[model samples]
Target chain A: MKKVKIYVTLRESVLDPQGSAVMGALHTMGYNEVADVRIGKYLELQVDDSERALDVIVKEMCEKLLTNTVIEDYRYDVEEAVSK
Target chain B: MKKVKIYVTLRESVLDPQGSAVMGALHTMGYNEVADVRIGKYLELQVDDSERALDVIVKEMCEKLLTNTVIEDYRYDVEEAVSK
Candidate 1:
């Protein structure tokens, strides 16, 4: 099996109100050293070996379901899965 | 400045309904090769230089604000911030 780790983040130009709210909370809690915060989604997928290339399949999944391309950008890493 | 990347994930025993929903959607969209899905939060923090050790600061932040220790586990990586 192959394991894919995908990170979907807001585009640089997009406003991240959620991130801002967290940063504010952090500051209020006395973590004044924190200058900024950006929040994003992290997804891990376990895929059974298939005829199609892993990268191709992952890109299609990201485009179709995992990411909102209009305001978010996604990138992924593929690795061999280790049996537990 | 230092850049801290934090990943907060559900504990192994916890149920992840959102992940299951996404996996179901993928299967409906014909990506049956995907066997499992797990979702988490990825957070990036920019921190100004401080008197405390970076790792110590990060760990405290994770435990106090970035994560819910009861049902979630968190890990972090710290690196020097790259000026843009």
Candidate 2:
């Protein structure tokens, strides 16, 4: 199996109100050194080995289901899965 | 400045319903090669230089705000921030 780690984040141009809220909370809690905060999604997929290229599969998955391409951008890393 | 990337994921013992839902959707969409899915949170913090240790600040933030330590675990990477 292959282990795929995907990160989906808001585009730089978009405003992240959620992030702002967290930053405010951090400041209120005395973490004044925090300048900014941005929140995103992280996904891990266990993909069974297949004839199809893993990159292509991952890209398709990101575009079709994992991400909202209009406002979000996604990137992934594929690695060999070690059995537990 | 320092760029801190934090990944917050559910502990192994917790059930991830959201991930299961995504996996089911992928199967419905014909991406059967995807065997499992796990979803988590990614946070990026732009931290200003300070006398306090970065690792110490990050750990405290994770425990107090960024993560729910009972069911979630968090890890982070700290890097020099590149001005854009």
Candidate 3:
């Protein structure tokens, strides 16, 4: 089995309203030290069978669905693990 | 100004229940190809002042609050930008 992680964020040039809301919430909670904030999403994926051809298949999936390559920057690594 | 990002995941030795639910949700949403999934929290923080000492102050914030450091693995970067 293999695992993939995807991190998604608005393009650097885009504004992040969600992040701002979070920062505001934190401030109201007494964490007034916080300033401009940007929010992003994190996702993890597990693959069923990579028996022999893992690299190619995973990369294709990442390109086609796991990520919006144009705006998100992601780093993924595959590690062998005992069956879940 | 500077920004901080914190990524928190269940320690490798612990089981992630929320993540499992999300995986199930995805499967039901027609992403049957998805398998074991893990979920984590992402946080973004903005700083107010760092007139001359940015690194030192930022590290203190990250260690004392922005992250739980005990159970989370975080990577943060600071870049200069026009004040917001």
Candidate 4:
């Protein structure tokens, strides 16, 4: 089995109000050492097989469905595992 | 300075066509042992200061702008580093 990990984040130009809030909280909580915080998402996937064609297929999926390429970006890690 | 790492990924129930494609590649690449692969996004943030109230601000930013909560989920890690 193959296990894949994907991460998504916003473009730098965009303002991150949410992160600002967290930074504010950390300061008030006495965790003043912390400077800023931004939140993203984690996606883990399991695939049936490994092949060169899969890369194209995956990229297409990301562009077409999985991600909003306009505002966010994506990356992934691949690993091998045995099926249960 | 504080650095925040955010991860964005799809829920397990969602179909990962992109991951399947990567798995196919590994198999064709002579790495037949590989089973699956999934892709996601990463977001790193640098905050101006660390404060207790920052947490709330950050969360709101993520909710309002950074991520698409419908199909994606997010999490973050916080650490302090000396500012240059």
TM-score of each: 0.97, 0.99, 0.54, 0.53
Query: What tens-digit string does per-residue lDDT give for candidate 2 at A1-84?
Result: 999999999999999999999999999999999999999999999999889888998999899999999999998888999999
Q: Give the least accurate 10-residue stretch of model 3 chain B, judged by summed lDDT.
A: B75-84
Q: Please tell me how candidate 2 rates in CAPRI terms.
A: high
Tens digits of per-residue lDDT for model 4 on B28-79? 6555644445556565667656344557755765676566898777777767
Candidate 4 residue-wise lDDT, A1-84, digit = tens: 566666666665766787678567656655555445555555565655645555664566557655688877777676764565
| Predicted complex 3: CAPRI docking category | acceptable
DockQ versus reference, model 1: 0.91
Q: Which runs in model 2 stand beyond 4 Å of their true positions? A: none
In candidate 2 the C-alpha lDDT for residue A3 amounts to 96
TM-score of chain A of each: 0.97, 0.97, 0.69, 0.81
By lDDT rank, best first, the candidates go: 2, 1, 3, 4
Residue pairs in collision within model 2: none
Reference contacts reproduced by model 1: 0.89
Better of 2 and 3 by TM-score: 2
Q: Which candidate is the best by TM-score?
A: 2
Please give, for residues A1-84, the per-residue lDDT of candidate 1 as tens digits. 999999899998999999999999989988889999999999989999989988888999999889999999998888999998
> Ten consecutive residues with minimal summed lDDT in candidate 1 chain A?
A50-59
- Residue B43 CA error for candidate 4 (Å)? 6.4
